[model samples]
Target: MIRWAASLGLILAITLAAPGAHGQSPAGAYETLRLIDGVRVLMNPADHASFASSNVVIIEQADGLVVVDSGFSRADGDQIVSYIRSFTAKPVKALIYTHWHNDHHQGASQIQAAWPQVRIIATEAARRGIDGPARLEGVGYETNPAWEALLAGQLRDVAARYQEAAANPENDAWRRHRFGQAAQQSLDGIPALVGTRLTAPTELFTADLVIDDPLRPVHIRHLGRANTDGDLIVWLPNQRVVATGDIVVSPIPFGFGSYPGDWIETLGRIKALGFHVLIPGHGLPQSDSAYIDRLIAAIADIRTRVGALAAEGLTLEQVRERVDYAEQTAIFGPSPARQANFQSLWLSPMTENAYKEATGVPIVQGQGELP
Candidate 1:
C-alpha cells in the first residue's frame, strides 16, 4: 500500500491514534497493525485505514539493544516503545535514524523518556538535518530561482495535500483526527522548546560499521545517497536481514525526493549486500532477494528511459508520456494520491539530480546535493 505523505519538516508534536468507541472508528482514528519477525523485524502500521507507516527496529546487540527509526507522532512513539518492551526489557541502548524525514525521527523524544540513557545515533548529515534546515532550504534563495520555484511548488503541493486530507472526513478520518491532535500538540510543543531537550544522537559517524555483538551482529552500511543525503541501510548478516530506508518500498520507490542514478546505485549496492531478507521502510517485510533484484532492474529501466529523454532534449512531461513503468506503478496501489508519487519521482530534486548525473550537468540551486 502507498503510505500517505506527511510534512517532512522537523516540527514538534505528539499525536495519538484514536481508538474507536464501541468498535466504531472515532472521528480520526486508525487501528494499529504490528508486523514482527520474532525479534528481527517490527513494523507499526500508522493510520491502519490509510497507508501511514513508520518503523521500530530492535537490534539485539552484544552489549545492549539498538533501536532504529521511530514512526510519526507521539502515538507511534508510544506504540513502538510498548512493542519493544514486550520483547525485551533491555533498555534501548542506541537509536539510529535512517534519514532525517519527520516520520522517521519525530518519535525519538518519546524513546528518550522510556530509555533515558539510550545513546541516539545518526549520521552527521542526518544529525545536522534534525538540528538544521534541509541543505536545499539553506541555499534556496542564494541558488537559481528556477530551482527554488521547483522546490517551493513541490512543498506547497505537499502542504496543500496534507491540508486537504486533514480536512476531509473520508480520505482518512482516522489520520485526520489523529494528526489533527498531533498538529495541536505541535502547537503546544512550542513552549517546551526553550528548555525542552530532545533526545539526539551523541555519536555521529560516516562509513560502514559492523556492530559485532552476538545478539545483534548487524552491518550498518552507508549506501551513499539514495533517498536523502544521509541514507543508510542496516544489514543483519546473521539473520540475513536488511532494512532499506525509503530506498525500496512496496509498489514504487518514493522518488519524489530521490536521486535516481544514486538511488539506482544504492539498489545495486543493496543487491550486492547478499542478504536473504529485505525489509523496506514501508509495507510488509519482503524476504525475497529476487524482489530486491527486481527493484534494481526497475530503477535501471527508469534511468534508461529518463536518460534517453534528456538525451533527446525532451521535456519531463514528454518523457513521462513516453516512459511507462506500469509494473512499478502498480506496486503503489490505486488512488489519486498516487499522482503525487509520479510528480515526486519526476519533478523532485532527486529526479533532477539523476538527470544531471546522467547528463554530467552541475546540479542547480534549490536542488539537493548528493553527499
Candidate 2:
C-alpha cells in the first residue's frame, strides 16, 4: 500500500542511495546499484519525500530475467521496463510481488504488458489480498484503479499546501527546503502514473517455491507474518542476498497494521538466513545486520512497553506519553528532526499495534485514506 507520508509535512527526508549504474539520470529517476554480477537494485528517488515507490530488484537468470517488486505507478513500471531493456535483451520471465502493498506491486501491469507470457508470482494470500480486503487501500488497485489520474488531479492542491508551508515564517529552514523538494518530486512522478492500470499476480503459491536456474536460481519462502498477513522473502542463495519487502526497511520502519510480536519472530527468521547483502523494500542495500538488529530491538521495546502499560490499564495516549524510545530512536539518528520521523513513522503505530496485539483488539487492514 502507498502512504501519503508527505501530508504529515512535519518531517520529510531523502535516503542516501547507491550511485546509479552507467551514470546519474535527471531528478525523479531512481538511482541504480549493481549488488553483484547479475542483480541491480533501483533505489526510489522520492523515498521519505513523498508518496514513494519501493526498491525494485532485477535479477538476471540463465534464460530470462526475474524481477522482485514492480513499483508504485505505471510510470515507474515504464521506467523499469526501459532499464530492463538497457540492462539485457532477455525478456522478463517472472515478476514477484513481496506483499499486497501497491507501492510494491501496483506497476505489475506494465511489466506483464512488456512480456505477455511473464508469470507474475506472489503468495496465494497476496494474490487474494491484491483484490481482497487485505490489499492496501490505494487509488490504482482493486475496483477503483485510477490512481494515476486521481493523484495527478490532487497534486495541485498538495503543491499549494507545500507552497503555503514554504511561505510560513514559523516553519524552520529545513521544513521549507524539504517542502520544495517534496513538491517537485511528487510533480515529476505524475507523468508515470498516467495510463497505469491495476494489475494482480497471475501465479500463487502457499509456501516455499523455487525458480530453478543454473546460474541464478531464486528461492522464495513465506516467513511468518510481519508487515502484512502474506509476506514473501526472495532468497538468492548463490548470491547470498535476500530481498525483504517491507518486512525490513531502512532508517525508519512502517508500523501500520503490523503484527508486532510476529514481526519480531519474522525478523529473526530473516537473520537466520545469513544474507551477505540485505535488500530492503525501501532505501539502500544493507550489508550488515546492524539496521535489522536495531529494528528488532525497537519493535520489541515498543510492543513490550505498550503491553505492559496496557496491562496496567493505561490508555493508549497515556502510554505513548509515558513510553520513552529516545535511546532507540537515536540509533537511527541523533537529531530532534530525525527523531520526530522515527516517532511518527515507526513508534506511533507500533505502539498501537503492540497494544492491539496484547489486548486482542482488531486492527483494520487497508483502511488508510488516499489522495
Per-residue error at 153 for model 1, in Å?
A: 17
Q: What is each predicted model's overall lDDT from 0 to 1?
A: 0.56, 0.74
lDDT of 1 by residue, 148-241 (tens): 3433343344344445557877756655765454444333333222211224566777977666675457677788877666788888876777
Give candidates' CA RMSD values in order: 8.2, 3.8
Per-residue error (Å), model 2, residue 229: 1.3
- Candidate 2's TM-score reads 0.87
Please, what is the TM-score per model? 0.68, 0.87
lDDT for 155 in candidate 2 is 56
